[model samples]
Each structure stands twice: as structure tokens, then as C-alpha cells.
Target chain A: MKKYLYIIKTTFNDSIQYISSLFIRFIGFAITMSILLSLWTFIYQDNTTISGYTLKEMFWYLLLTETITFGSKSPVATNEVKNCIKSGNIAYQINKPYHYIIYSITKYFADTLIRFIAFTIISTILGLIYVGPINNISIISFISCIPVFLLAVLITGMIKILISLTSFWVEDSQPFQMIYSKIILIFGIFFPIEMFPKIIGNILRYTPIYSVSYGPAKLMLSYNFSFFLNILITQIITIIIISIIINIVYRRGVRKLNVNGG
Target chain B: MLTEVKNNLKIMFLSLKYNLIRVMENRVSFLTSVSMMIFNNASFIIQWLTIFTLVEYIGSYTLNDIMLFWAISSGSYGLANILFNGANKIPEYIENGKLDAYLVMPKNVLCHVITSSTEPSAWGDLIYGYIALIIFNFSIKNIFLYSLLIIIGALIYTSFVIICNSFTFYFIRFSETSEILKDIFINGSIYPDVIFNRAIKIIFFTLIPCALASWVPVHLIIEFNIYHFILLILATNILIIIAFFLFYQGLKRYTSSNLMEARS
Candidate 1:
């Protein structure tokens, strides 16, 4: 655990210099999100409620959804690979002591930390001044739920790595990356998966992505012990499955790499 | 000037052809990107449709008016996406010293840079926007006039984007500027110009020129305003000329050190 913390801290320190640009982006993100949410708020003004929730509840739903969604890091594995491929720079990395996936995971950890801080700052400011606190979850639940949320981020990054590795076999990985990211955005963004159509939503609820997004969100916003436990179990199993698949793909990718030329 | 224009047009087509071939080489990636773009645009259309179903209009515009506006805005957006996405990466290229290769090319350095990274996905957005326009309640009576106006609108929008990208010469670091420009187009142009007061409308039309991209053309197309159409065409020509001049001027200032260090 100490070694892991040291690695994470080193990664975070390396990325801290780039945090200023993210601050600018976060401001723009906050303003746009606020306006979009406020529009929904206005639209729901005439109605008493939507799907058995009040306007404030709906606003909270949008805010919390936006927060968690923003917390989700950009899928950068494909991008990193593309840059390496374009510049023929992967050879240098292949010789490095650390594994590629571990390096990527570290980078994403640093990236996600930046995202979390930027988003937390933005949301906290907005929540204090413009809107109020979202929900009143118990302190114990809030504290305990942090690790589950971090695990969710880990799975998300792993999923990105798996998709990016497909670039090894495929000609262009960007489109796939864009599509998968969009899926993450839509299903994970404005509303929880449960708010989706009943049958599809129920299925999505059991999936790894649901645990990554909705589970953590619900735990933070509203304490649901049973749902949380179910999500934890599902996440553990899903991680194993995803890890096996990733390992297989990674080996194949290394075999197929045009390392000699580029 | 006429010969230069013809040569540039030829180069543009050649570059576009080359890009198309390169993109097609990566079939799966190209198709996936295209499909995702189509889906993204379709999602917007559906959202607009749901809103229209719930409400008669956003402000004074009817459902048809709103759809028409979205159609023009989205289509212009598609053209802009194709043309300037490469230029948008200027910062990265400059910082990474990738601009070196383009500078060594025989053809126009700017054109080469712009053509190297065409987003084939934009075609999906273009198709969706066009389909929306065709399905909308607009009369088919002025099809030729509307088509001409939209073409001019696309040209003007493309020119403005070129000008925005040329700012890499002076600003050098333009992340904030680019973000603000994107926000201006995305938020300001989606709705009708009339929704804004006359002052803001004038500002959008003249300063930002987003009105030419969507609002002015859509309005003139619907109302059959010959004067607005003529004005839009004239503005398009002027903007294109200015864009070309500024691009060349900026190119002159693009020194080795700037190319090496600038983040654009």
C-alpha cells in the first residue's frame, strides 16, 4: 500500500504543472453545465414533478450526474498510443522498466485526480453560491463510499485501455474510442442508468459501467446499502473478467506491434 | 488572382481526395467515427424534436423555424468541422515540432496542415442536417435560392474559422480563445438571431459572423428576403478575402522558434 501510494503521488506530482489549463476548461465546463441544467430547471417549472421527483430533486439529479460524469476521466489510452505511433516513440517506452498498462494507469490516475479537484472546486463553489448542497447522505456512507468510487474509476480506465488496445488490430481506433466515450457520456451523463427505459436500464444497472457511474453516484447522493453491496460484488467479478480480456489483448497486441519500423 | 483561386480550388480538391483515400484505408475506424457522428447529431435532432413536441416554439420561432435554424447551423458546423479541425491542432503541432514536416512540403503549408487531419465524421453531421432540412415544413419553392445561400453561409463560416486559426501567429497560446469561439458558435448561433436584441444580433452578424453561418441565411431562405441573401453573399466574399490575406500575413510571422515553441 505504501509503495502504491508513493507511485500515485509521484504520478500526481508530474501532472500537477498542467493543472492550470484544466482550471480554465473547468470554468467553461461549469458555465455550460450550469446553463444547460438551468434550462432543464426552467422547462420543469410548469410541471409539479417528473418521474416522481420534484424540480429540486431533478436539479440535484442533473448536478450530481454532471459531477460524477465529469469525474470520469477522458479515455486517453488510444490517444497515447496514436501519439506514440505517429512519432515512432513507443520503442523508448517498451524499454522502460514499468509495464505499459501500469504507466497508463498511473497517467490516468494523475489525470483523474486533476479532474476530481477541478470538478470538486467548481461544484463546491457553485453549490455554495448558486445552488445549495445536493443531498444529505450520512457521513459514514460518504466516507465508506469513496473507495468504491475509486474502484469504479479504475474499471473505467481499464475499459479505456482495452478499447485502445483494439487499435493494434484495427486500422483506426479513434472512432471506436469516440463511440465508446459517447456511450459512457450519454448513459452516464445527465441521468442515472435507472432513469433510462426500464428493461435496458435494468440490464445496464448490472453491467460494469453502471457500477462505475451510477453505483458510486447513488451511494454519494443517496445511501442505498443493498445496492452498494450488489455493485461491489459485481465490480469485483467484472474486474476479473475485464482483466483476463485485457491480458489476452495485450499479448496479441505486443505480438502484432510493428516495433522494427515504427 | 483568378488563377490563384483556381489553383487553390484544385489543390483543395486534390488534398480532399488524398485525405478521403487515407481515411478509407482505415475502414473500421472511419466507419465507426462516421457512425458516432451520425448518432451524436441524431441525438440532438431527437432532443429538438422532443422539445418541439412539448412546446410550440422557443421564443417567437415555430417548430419548423427552429428545425430550419438547426439544419443550417448543424450543416455549417459540419463544414467547419472538416475544414478547421486540423488547424485547431496547431498548438499541438507547433509544440511538438510536427509542423517541420509540413513546412518542407511543396504545396501551401497551411493547406497541407489543414488537409492532413480531415474528420470524415463530419459528413454524417452534414447528412443528418440536410435530411432534417428536407423533412421540415419549409416550402420547396425556393430550393435553388436556399441552396445557394447555404453554400455561401458555409463559405463564410469556413473563412471565419480559418481566420480564428490564423491567430496562432500572434496569440500563440489560444486555448481560452478557441474555447470562447466554440462557445460563441455553439450557444449563439443555434437559436435565431431575432431572439437576441438588435445590438447583439448586429454584433453576432458582423463581429462573430455566426449569423451568416446560420441565422441570416435561414431567415432569408424562409422569408424570401432577396436583400439579406445578397448581403450574405457579399459578406461571404469579403470574409473569404480577408481570411486569405490574414492567413498569408500570419504565415509570414510563423518563425522557426515560434513553430518550435508556440502552443497556438
Candidate 2:
């Protein structure tokens, strides 16, 4: 635990070096948010409600999705993981006392924490100014959602690590990364699962992708105690499953590397 | 001057040919990238579909009109990236002193640098754009008009990106600013112009100029407006001239990193 804490501390310190870049990226996010705000404003121009969301609710929904999608990006971890496998750099970490996966997870968590904090602040201000307060959100629900949001971040990191591991087989992991991101964008980030066709929405709820994005955002929008409990349980189960998969995959990959003398 | 232009075109052609061959060497990777881009581009249409299903029109744009808008936007972005892909890499090149090679070349450094690479996924955008046009309705006159608009739009997009990236010469690390500016321009181009207020519309026309990339072109196609067409042509030319002028002015400030590297 202490080792991981140290890793997180150092990673956070390193991330501070690129504060200007992060600020610029936040500006990019603000621009995207403005575009969506304008778009949804236009869409809601004729009707106050479409598919059970008011104009305000729709903007709030977009705000949550954008925040979650942008905040949890771990580009440094993604690049490191891909390069480690591609260039056989994993060998250097393989001999380390600490686990490479844990090290990577800590670095990713640090990066995500910094970005999420910055994005939350910016988005909150923007939301206040652009859409005003979301009346549906309960104070209790908002407080309870802290753990859920952290789990969502973890799930996101795990998924990225899994994608990056594909570099062992493929020459470039960028295409895989692109495809996965698009899938998330279409199904998870852009539109709420509720807006999906009934059958599709129901099926997506069963998948981990729902827990990663839609579940958290939906809870923030309109939280039900029972629904919140279900989301929490689902995310924990998914995290466990993904962790096991990562363990198996990483171990086998390392073995293959050893055999191939990579 | 004519002979010089001819030689530069030849160099560009060869560069594109070689880049294409190199990318195609990994057939699976190339195909995957192209297919993924197509899917990515197509997904945005779903958002529009969701909107139009609820409302008949958005700011005077019907579903068909919006489709035309996307076709022009994607086609123009694709052509710009395919022909002048390295414009996107200018900040990185300038930062790492990679422009040294282009400086040594006899060709126009700006043209040589921008035309040195081709993006494989842009082909997907180009194909998808035409597919959208076909869905709207295919006609000879429309095709001619679309082709001309796409060329002008490509010029605007490329020149805008080059000008933004050339800021690296003035600022030591302006990559982030360049990237954000380019993203804003591209994102602004994707939406209908009617959504923006008069002030933003003016800014989009003059400062960022995303309207030239998609909205104005789509407008002209939907209704032949010679005035808007002439305006777009003038804007594109002015942007190109500005891009060239800024690039040359910045060239004086470029202190090479002196890193030993070669362009493949």
C-alpha cells in the first residue's frame, strides 16, 4: 500500500509538469461542451421534453457524459502499456519488486484524479452558468456517488489496460484503441442507455460498459436508492471479473515473452 | 514559376505514392484503420437521427440538408488530411527541429512538408462523404459542384491548420494551443450554422472560419448563391495567402533542435 502510495505521489508530481497542456485540454473540453450545449439547445427548441428529459436535464446529461469520458482518460498509461509490450520494455519491469500492473494502475489513477478534478471544476462552473442547477439530483445521492465514480474510473483504466495488452499480438494498438473508444462514445458516453431502443438498452445494462459511464451519470441525474445499490454491486462484480482477466492475461503474456526471449 | 509548380506537384505525387505503399504494406492494419474511421464518422449521424426523429428541423436544416452538411464537412476534412497530412504534425516538427530536412529541400518548404505524408483513414472519410452524397441524390451538376466545394473546403482546412501550428515559432510550446484551436474549428464545422447566434456566426465566418469548411458549401449546394460562393472562394484564397505569409515570417524564428533524424 505504501509503495503504491509513493507511486501515486510521484506520478501526480510528474503530471504537474504538464499543467499547461492539461489546461489547454480542459479548454478543448469546454469547447466540446459548448458545442453539445448549443446542439441540445437547438434540439430542445421545439419540444420541452423528448424521451422523458427536459431541456435542462438533457444538457445536464451531456455534461455528465462529457465529464466522465474526458476526465478518466489515461493516455500516459495507455502509451506506456502499449510500448512495454511492443518494444519488449516489459522485461525491465518484470524483474521489479512491485507488480507492473499495480504500478501502471497507480500511475493511471493519479493521472485520472488530476484530470477529473480539473474537469469537474470547469464543468461545474459551465453547468451553473449555462444550464443552471439540476433539480433532480438529491444531496444524499450525490454524496453516495463518490465511490461509484471511483469504481467507474477503475473500470475505465482496466479496459484501457486490456486494450493496450493487445499490442503483444498487433503491430499497433491505435486501431483497437480507436475502435473501443468509438464503441464507448456511441453506446456509453454520448447518449444515455435509456435513450437506446428498449431491447438494446436492457442488454447494455447487463454489460460493464454501462457501469463505467451510463450508470454513474444516470445516478447523478435521478438517483433511486435501489438503483444506486444495484449499480454499486454491478461495478464491484465487474471490477473483480476484469481484475482476474488482467491477471491471467498479463501472466500468460509475460510467459510468452520469456519463451520468445523478448 | 510554372516549371517550379510542376516540379513540386511531381514531388508531391511521388511522396503520396510512397506513403500509400508503406501504409498498405500492413494490409490488415490499413483496412482496420479505414473501416474504423468509416464507423466513427457514421456514428455521428445517429445523433442527428435521434434529434430529427423528435423534431422536423434544426435551425432551417432538415435531415437531408444536415446529411449534405456532413458530406461536405467529412469530404473536405478527408481531402485536406490525405493531401496535406503533415500540416497536423507541424507543431511537433517545429518543436523537434524536424523541419531541418524540408528546409534543405529545393521545393517550397511549406508544400514539401505538408505533402510529405498521407493519412490512410482519410480515405474512409472520403468514401463515406461520397456515400452520403449519393444518399442525398446523385447528379452530374451536383457532383461537379460538390467536387469544387470540397477542394475549396480542403484548402481552407489545411491552411487554417498550418497557420495555427506555425505559432510554434513564436511560442516555445504552442502544440496544445494549436491542437485545441484545430479541434474547435473542426468541431464547429460539424454542426448546422443556424444554431449559432449572429455574433458566433460572424466569428465562425471571419476568425475561425468553419462555415467555409461545411456550412456555406452546403448552403450553396442546397440553394445556388453566387454571392456566398464568391465569398467562400475569397476567404479560402485569403486564408491560403495568410498561411503562406505567417509560415515564412515564423520561419525566421525557427531554431533547429539539431536532432539527427530522417523522414522515411
Task: Write down the TM-score of every candidate.
Answer: 0.76, 0.94
Off by over 4 Å in 2: A136-139, A258-262, B257-261
* Per-residue C-alpha lDDT of model 2 across residues B1-264, encoded as one tens digit per residue: 999999989999888888888889989877887888888888877777766767888877788788888899899999998889999989888888899999988889998889888899998888888888888747778788999999999999999999999888999788888888888888889888878778888888888988888888998888889988998888899999999999999999998888888788
In order, the TM-score of chain B in each prediction is 0.84, 0.96
Instruction: Write one digit per residue (lDDT tens) for candidate 1, span B1-264.
Output: 788768866887777777678778978767777777877765655445545544455667776777777777777777666654575666556545577777776667776676566777877767766777777744566456556666676677667767776777777576477666767666666765544656766778777888778888777767777787677778888998887788788767666644443312
Which stretches in model 1 have alpha-carbon errors above 4 Å? A1-6, A54-56, A74-76, A81-103, A135-145, A224-237, A251-262, B1-33, B43-70, B81-118, B134-146, B187-211, B216-231, B234-264
| Cα-based lDDT at residue B210, candidate 1 | 83
Q: What DockQ, between 0 and 1, does each candidate earn?
A: 0.19, 0.66
Best by lDDT: 2
Which candidate gets the maximum TM-score versus the true structure?
Answer: 2
The top-ranked prediction according to DockQ is 2
Score each candidate by Cα lDDT. 0.68, 0.85
Error of 2 at B26 (Å): 3.0
